[model samples]
Target: WQVFRFAAPALMAGNAALLKHASNVCGSALEIEAVFREAGFPKDLFRVLLIESGEVAALIARPEIRAVTLTGSNRAGESVGAAAGKALKKTVLELGGSDPYVILADADVEHAVQVTVQSRLTNSGQSCIAAKRFIVVPEVREAFERGVVERMKLASCGDPMLESTQVGPLARLDLREGLHRQVRESVAAGARLILGGEIPSGPGAFYPPTVLSEVKPGMPAYDEEIFGPVAAIIPVKDEEAAIAVANDTSFGLGAAVFTRDLARGEKIAKERIEAGSCFVNALVKSDPRLPFGGIKESGYGREL
Candidate 1:
């Protein structure tokens, strides 16, 4: 999705693309290049450079490399952005996010919980726009938490190749370890662990769907992006406090609001939430027809 989002427009404009995909996904990168080639695009029009991270600086310094775009961690974005700045090349970066899902007082608790859990567990919670924080108003917080825990517990982690697998192992072992560390630290910091927080003994890098309630500002669950299947539930006093908690994060990638009242949901999604894309009664997602990307540390510029 990231490759095609930028490649389609650049190809249309008659500009070539040089992709430097993540080190672990080299085969997928080559497959993408082959896809363009098979579709009759010029042989060299879309090229994959299987290069090391240290080599990126020299590659960006090359005069033939026009604009640069990346979808990765903030650290990678900072490195690429610095190199691009030095080379005076136009750049677009789509970085990490900890998107918030706000559940209003009048929201259908069941529907909200279903959507929130599904969003949070998407891609084993690897996606940048995957909902991370669940900010619920006092009226529905208890029920919302209960529903979320039940739904999350139902998700079975297994081989991704199996159609029955709702959740799979994370992409790397280090990521699973990092996520577990966050869960532990958060729990020690007073965040209530209401569901699976254990690292299962398995062959693959699997972490179970975990839930942490009473997540506050100082906890890792609240302050950092948990890039795995973990849901952080934050309780807010009312609508005003919910919105405040939702916007308190440095990320401005994607957010969603759930409410029974359509007008109220729309109003909050449009005017109250601070994000590049805000949705009402749905999980925030990217579509080919709509503009995508984010702001603040989540990065600037748009893609779709």
Candidate 2:
């Protein structure tokens, strides 16, 4: 979806595109290129480059390469932006995110929980706009935690080919290990593991839907983007504190506020949420009709 998000618009604008896909997904990238060719578009109009990350600088430096678009970590964005800037090239970067999902005291708890679970678990929670932080008012904190844990416990994990499978393995074993490390460090930092922190003994890169409670500053679960099926629940005293915690992060990709008070929610979402897109009583998602991007350390420029 991401590969096509940027490519489709560029192609529609009659601009040639050179895609530098994530190394691990090279086959998928090639498939996209093949599809375009089979559809009778000129072959030269679309190309996929399978090259090492180190080779990107040279590619960007080429005079023919007018622009660059990257969707990756902050580290990759920094390198790509640097190379593109040095060559006076236009660059679009959609990097890391620690998006906050705020649950106000007056919110519909059931609806909020449902949206929260779906948003946090979409794409196995490996998404830039996925709800990484759950900021809840103290009055409903316990209820929210319980609801999240119940939904997570019901998640079925196995081969993604199976229609019944709700959760699948990570893209790679190294990614699974990295997520486990973040879980371990967060637990050690005093966050309570409410559910699913274990790395299952299996052939594939499988990790269960994990939930962390009492997440606060100084903990990885609270401070960093854990790009997996891990939910960090941080309880605050009120709306002021909830907004404070939401804006505390350096990444400002997307954010959501859940409240029955429509006027209050909209006011806060528009005026206080420091993100590219803010939603009231809903999960943050990218729509074709609206622009998608991030601010602060997440990245810059819009995608779709």
Candidate 3:
């Protein structure tokens, strides 16, 4: 999706695309080039380069490469942005996010929980716009927590190739370890572990659907992005507190607000929540017709 989002427009504008994809997904990148070829586009119009990260700076410095765009972690974004700036080239960065979902008192508890769990577990919670911090008012916090735990617990974690697998392993073992470390540190810092928090005894990099409640500002679950199937639930006093908590993070990629009143939801989404894409009652998603990007440390410029 990310590749096509940029490649489609560039090709339509008669520009060739050079894809230097992440090493872990090299197979998919090759397949994408093959897809472009099979679709009857000119050969060599879209090409994939299997190169090391260190080689990118030199490639960007070349005059042939017009602009640079990246979708990765903050560290990688910083490196690429620095290189592109040195080369005096245009750049677009779609980096990390710790998206928040605000649940008000009037929201249907069941519906909010269903959507929150779905958003959190999408791509095994590896998405930049996946719901990370769930801020709920006191009126619905307990009910929302209970419902989220039940729904998350029901998700089946297994092989990605299986149709029955609702959850899959992390992309790498180090990533799983990093996510587990965050969960442990967050719990040690006073977050309550209400659901799966342990690393399962498995052959794959599979972490269970974990839930942490009472997530506060200092804890990792509250402070950093957990790139796995872990949900952080933060309880706030009222609507004002909820909004404050939602915007407390440095990331401003995406956010959602749930309320029974459509007008109230829209107002909060439009005015209160700080994000590039704000959804009133649905999960934050990317559409080709709408611009997709982030603000603050989440990076700059739109993709589609």
Among all windows of 10 consecutive residues in model 3, the one with the lowest summed lDDT is: 272-281
Q: Which candidate, 2 or 3, would have the higher lDDT against the true structure?
A: 3
> Model 3, residue 67: what's the lDDT?
93
Which of candidates 1 and 2 is the stronger one according to lDDT? 1
Report model 1's TM-score to 2 decimal places. Answer: 0.98
Task: For model 2, give the 10-residue run with minimal summed lDDT.
Answer: 281-290
TM-score of each: 0.98, 0.98, 0.99
Global lDDT of each model? Answer: 0.93, 0.91, 0.94
What value does the lDDT take at residue 236 in candidate 3? 93
Q: Indicate whether candidate 1 or candidate 3 has the larger lDDT.
A: 3
lDDT of 2 by residue, 56-121 (tens): 999999999989989999999999999999999998899999999999998999899999989998
User: For residues 50-120, could you state the per-residue lDDT of candidate 1 as single tens digits?
Assistant: 88999999999999988999999999999999999999999899999999999988898999998999999
Q: Write the per-residue lDDT of candidate 3 for residues 77-132, one digit (tens) a residue.
A: 99999999999999999999999999999998898999999999999999999999
For model 3, the stretches where C-alpha displacement exceeds 4 angstroms are none
RMSD of each: 1.0, 0.9, 0.8
How much is 5 displaced in model 1, in angstroms?
1.5
- Using lDDT as the measure, the top candidate is 3
